[model samples]
Target: MSPDQAQAQGRLHDTDPVGIIDIGSNSVRLVVYERLTRSPTVLFNEKVLAGLGRGVGVTNRLADDSVERALAALRRFRFLATQAGAETLYVLATAAAREAENGPDFIREVQKITGAKVEVLSGRDEAERSAYGIISGIWRANGIAGDLGGGSLELVDVRGEEIGDGRTYPLGGLRLQDAAEDSVRKAEKIAADALDGCSLLDGGAGRAFYAIGGTWRSLARLYMFETGYPLKVMHHFAIPAGEALDFCRKVAREDLAGFEHIDVISRSRRALLPYGAAVMEQIIRRAQPTEVVMSALGVREGHLYKLLSKKERARDPLIAASEELAILRSRSPRHAGELADWTGRLFEVLEVEESADERRLRTAACLLADIGWRAHPDYRGEQSLNIIAHAAFIGIDHPGRAYLALANFYRHVGLIEEELSPWIRKLATTRLMERARILGSAFRVAYLISAAMPGVMPKTTVRRRNGELVLELPKDIADLDGERLRKRFSQLGRLMELSADVEIA
Candidate 1:
């Protein structure tokens, strides 16, 4: 490799690329993450549907052809993991591998091929890990987390950081499909029977039900496409219980090919949608959750989260992710930190009433404020908006994502509603929209004063005194103030409904 390539590789090595081989009943997936941070970024990810538990319910053994396909995929994944510089590899086998008669033998072969210890999780173990994945991704997750794989469904209760014992059922898509002979009516009966009188779901009443697994994600995607949802993000996508129940009933009972946007789902996954929907419909009917929230993270991410120290686990995932981006893409990470503190102090002086969650979102926006500086001056706003809107960020919902994106866009392009997309505006509340404009205006003023440097912002102060917003610049940097700075400060003052002044202190 060239010296520059070698140097880049060395930098990546410091972050520690970790690989996970998830052997599920329906698919074998390999995901190599850039690092094992709270909001882990994927370096490479690939999956192959192997249907390892196709007939395990009746046959009690993994299918021969399915085993061959899984092994082939495992071999390729092992090589790919090494190529991606993954020094650590974790192989986790879910319901199919633990239940099949030949599961032990299959696991041995997997260990040999991948040169890693294979962990065959029990039903409870699977549930806990899936719940941990939810905890890692969502902020203070509560309610039941159900992971519906091809072989089994693991349900566990979570309240904040506490995870309850989980129960497993044979309601997985492939297993249910086989048990019901591919009949939707029969699938519904089986799902009802499996979930009937399950005390684990009792606590989920009036709370959220976090859905995991590919089939459910596919279902969520179909929902997004059908509703013309503005944001395409899947994580934290929420559907009201009544609405989800009705939708699931339709998906389970109706013909899949007839759906308007059925093409959004892969053909391989289409056959199992009815079965998956049947199971989800039963859960919502029985649990009566307030809403169904989709989670992109699952067993793999959960397993990695378990490896962190208590201190690391305590950090806010959204802040950690934003800081990482600022370090990688901003003109100065230190300046971003300073800007966050400066804005925070300004908000307090202006008596802005902000909730704890709103404060966190604002800090994250500040860290991400300058990531698009390298883009063409004219298109910087558009590029920043698009990138932040669609970034693979967790611990936040759709509205929070919109706030971050809109704040940065306003910072770059000025606070003008006409230039913003109505679709983006639809995601945030009116209060959040106004707050975004205030933050963006503040950023405009800060950048002008600091030139995106570190030392200046810390020494400057913005305060409200005697019916005016006063920006007190330290005398040494007083000359940095200009007509453009005054105009930007005035814009911020207008947003706060206060007169603006600049004073040399």
Candidate 2:
């Protein structure tokens, strides 16, 4: 295709790039998304920690040095967003700019520099946006969502699609650090006192505590590193309440430098770790949640998600992302959709027990099955596995991500355990591993029969007969079935502990 044709095809169903310039208490960030998608893809993301809220606790004014740094960052961000083809730029300022005495001056300067109207979010607005972010990223999220920023903490109750009014506290990392005079004990007391008898957290008992913002994400990263977790994906990383409480206590009271992985964190963020941990410890103590879940989404994503139509908001992020990938990379996107239906029918005929969530994952895997077809034959599985395993996907847990990646891997490389990575295996349960194998085996058989095309797989049928799994090919395509297909079919049957045969309809 010509350059123009290629570009036109690429932008067919894609919306114009949208940019978000978030001026937070701790950092000034610029994120240009591919579009206002359910699962927005970050085309460009950059942040500068200007400590905009550093002196706000005591002086109640945005510091001069921080203001200069922030303004400089905004100027550059405006240029970068334009270069990135961002059609619209949404500028949002949180706690620092809203609370500080000199906040209005800073906002005016930002508006002038970026040539965009700045929406200084109120505490309630911040909390609501953060909650919306959790709703957008996590499927059927049920629990309390908390965003710990540099200047404040926003907490709100979330139950599926319903979100309660948000409450804000002055328990931000920088604020707490300043209030406690860098003393861990005082910080702990301050956090405890602020969150004491907070009704929002009271509703969080036995539910999830979704942690948002950079400081909390950094804290989760530390935990992930310390525990040697297999998948590095941050969203939906859950830790039990008891374990998280203990870890937070250690981080709050103990010396952070004593930890071996402390070096992994940025030096700029190291000082605030204790404060963040202290606040988290207080939250856990108060809420008694079932688990503390980390959410990478926050006010920025929430704001974007709010702009989407209600119908668009209701789409499953994982499936939408998977289908988008298939459309962009697969040989035939229609074939991928057909593959999903075909597999569903096969599972139904075979009486495979699949939960609603599992079926959703299987369908996502089907959509993504052929995404790696363009890679070299020998390395297709490895390439596809890496892409899906670490893709910027949301709404699915790590185990589901593993299933999708493994199914495609198995489709390309066959169901061979020896070739799989041990770390990836550690992420999924035994049941999921087996399901991946079965789906992979199914993909192998389906692809061999259809040649990655549409219509063929739908026409063929698989059924159980006389204690055997039989694959029936219509008379017209009977010549297409042979020893190779029979061998693949038998391999699939062996995994299910059944004999298999192929016959002409």
Error of 1 at 262 (Å): 0.9
lDDT of 1 by residue, 248-335 (tens): 9999988887889999999999999988999999999899999999999989999999998889899999999899889879999999
For all candidates in order, the CA lDDT equals 0.92, 0.91
| lDDT per residue (tens digit) for residues 63-97 in model 2 | 99999999999999999998888869999999999
Residue 478 shift from truth in candidate 2, angstroms: 2.0
State which candidate has the highest TM-score: 1
Return the lDDT, model 2, position 469. Answer: 92
User: What's the CA RMSD for each of the models?
Assistant: 1.4, 1.8
The best candidate by lDDT is 1
TM-scores of the candidates are: 0.98, 0.97
